[model samples]
Target: MSEADVTVIGAGVVGLAVAAALAARGRKVYILEKNEGIGRETSSRNSQVIHAGLYYPPGSLKARTCVEGNRLLYQLCARYGVPHRRLGKLVAATEAGEEPRLEALASNASASGVAGLRFLTSREVAVLEPRVRARLGLLVPDTGIVDVHRLMELYLWLARERGAELVCRTEAVGLEFTGAGYLVWVRDREGTYAFRSRVVVNSAGLRADRVAAMAGLDVDRLGYRLHYCKGHYFSVCPAKSRLVSRLVYPVPHPQGTGLGIHVTLDLGGRMRLGPDTLYVSEPEYGVGEERRHLFWEGARRFLPDLEPEDLSPEMAGIRPKLQGPGQPPRDFVIRHEADRGLPGFVNLIGIESPGLTASPAIARLVAGMLG
Candidate 1:
């Protein structure tokens, strides 16, 4: 097989974005995906909300990339005519006890370079969302949703236009460092094959840790092990879809298991609630039918008008986590292992949440690292 200057594994949004960035720099980039198509997993099955750099710890990659990526994403969308909306978001504090978390989020957001956040009184929230009952609200003018498929399509198109080759259903099964470069052993419908590249980017999302291990990195020993945290979403019944115009969030779990069951509106104005976190033994994407009542109870905090039957199973996605239950939040691990005596190999693990928003920025950062 012909050698590539740079090869990226995993054709999810981050990998595709990384390819786009590398290709733009005139690198001979190639992408391989295990799935038959891009975004078959966590990329497409997500909240699809453009986070406003609000919930991450200060100085973390998630914070920095999300802040910058959010800005860059809007520009890319506009440039490529990608379908999206900066329709804004409202994170509400429905109970008095939750108001402290609101203050902390505002402070953290400001520290993370998020601008134009304004606290709202109950009356103001009532004016904006008549059905929402909250004692206080935080309006983030920058949060929005995009047609993610279109966004990925643009990235793939841009990469291809720049001479990057993307082959779906190609799985990288082995990685070994050599004098010439890194050898990537891959398999596809045709058969197993191998190629060499000066740089290898492991953006394999849920399987990122395994990819790292293929390069001789001791993931568990290095604390780079990935925990699969599953989150479920339930779309609101059409009768109640008009109940929200903005993304309405309850106070996030204090431990950051996942964002609480909150309301999100698609660009089409349909509402969905979801994403309670459950640590699973495997990478299961099945929505728990038994958890619908829990969704109703949690979302009913601010969405008081929701009936028990107002929600139904929508979808589920798994997060590749570095932090497990009750652990302090973990930052994304994106490092070129030069210090490990292996240069030009980058590992990205636990890139959940703001990953979609931060994808472009991440690509640029990778390009800069290679530079």
Candidate 2:
């Protein structure tokens, strides 16, 4: 069996960040990725927005990490030449009566310690985004976009530089917790084997709950069972895409299932709208052309000029959510599992949206947990 000081299951952004953090702390690390490459799943499939810690409750992991990670990620991107933009974002109150909701969102963000938030009047918003129609706007300067591919690559490179090993196309099928450490049972094209480690971090994005179950945890009983929430994105035609230079969003969903179909620009400034929430039994990435109207209708509230034909099915991503449909928002579950008789097994579950934004902070948090 191969041996390492730490084994991180899954190679999504969070896993890579955790591996990098632990390795940087002088812990020998091994990253096992089931896919052919890192971040093939939700890591590479979403809007890639660096969230501003606006929506999560104050003092929650989502808020704390997002705010901290926002700063860290900006520093990393600038230092490493990662493709990114601090183009900012606009949370709009498109209708007259919606200004109260916009104010509430700002208040929540303020309580979460989000800085550089400014309220803009309709005239001010129009001055900044002529194409948008909103009664009021919250200009969040910390909100931006990043090239997730480049960010993940940087994390992997950092980990490898610190003497970490990445084994791709390998899946951790089962985990056996030894008295002192863990024996990670894994499989590849060849066969199955075990990798012994002093510490194991289950960072499996979509299958985190399953990985926890493998470690003999009662996932369902503990509320670690994940509900797959699929969201679809539609790219705006180039002609219409240039209408906005910043990310534009409507008041978020009342239940917090999604941020509402709004506008997000890539690093290259190509606009896309999407990610309406739909709970699914499995992770599926098929985008229906028929849903183009939904995107147009949703964004048309603020983007008055938008038409259905401007949208084209882009991609779909699934969030490993802790909350099912109509359920209240759930905070991220990051625990060492020592209380449950597994000393060094850290489980990161329900790490959906803001996860990418919170990765670096999550890494630091995990490293501290292990240490």
TM-score per prediction, in order, is 0.98, 0.99
Write one digit per residue (lDDT tens) for candidate 1, span 1-371: 59999999999999999999999999999999998899898998888999999998879899999999999999999998998999899999988789999999999999999999999999999999999989999999999999999999999999999999998889999988996689899999999989899999999999999999999989889999988899899988898999888899987868668888888888888888878899998987788679989999998889899987888898898988899877887899989898997799998889999999999999999989889
- lDDT by residue (24-108, candidate 2, tens digit) is 9999999999999999999998999999999999999999999999999999999999999999999999777778888998999
Best by lDDT: 2
> Candidate 2: misplaced stretches above 4 Å?
none
Q: Which residue segments of model 1 deviate by more than 4 Å?
A: none
Could you tell me which residue pairs clash in candidate 1?
A: none
Q: Rate the local accuracy (lDDT) of all candidates.
A: 0.91, 0.93
- TM for candidate 2 is 0.99
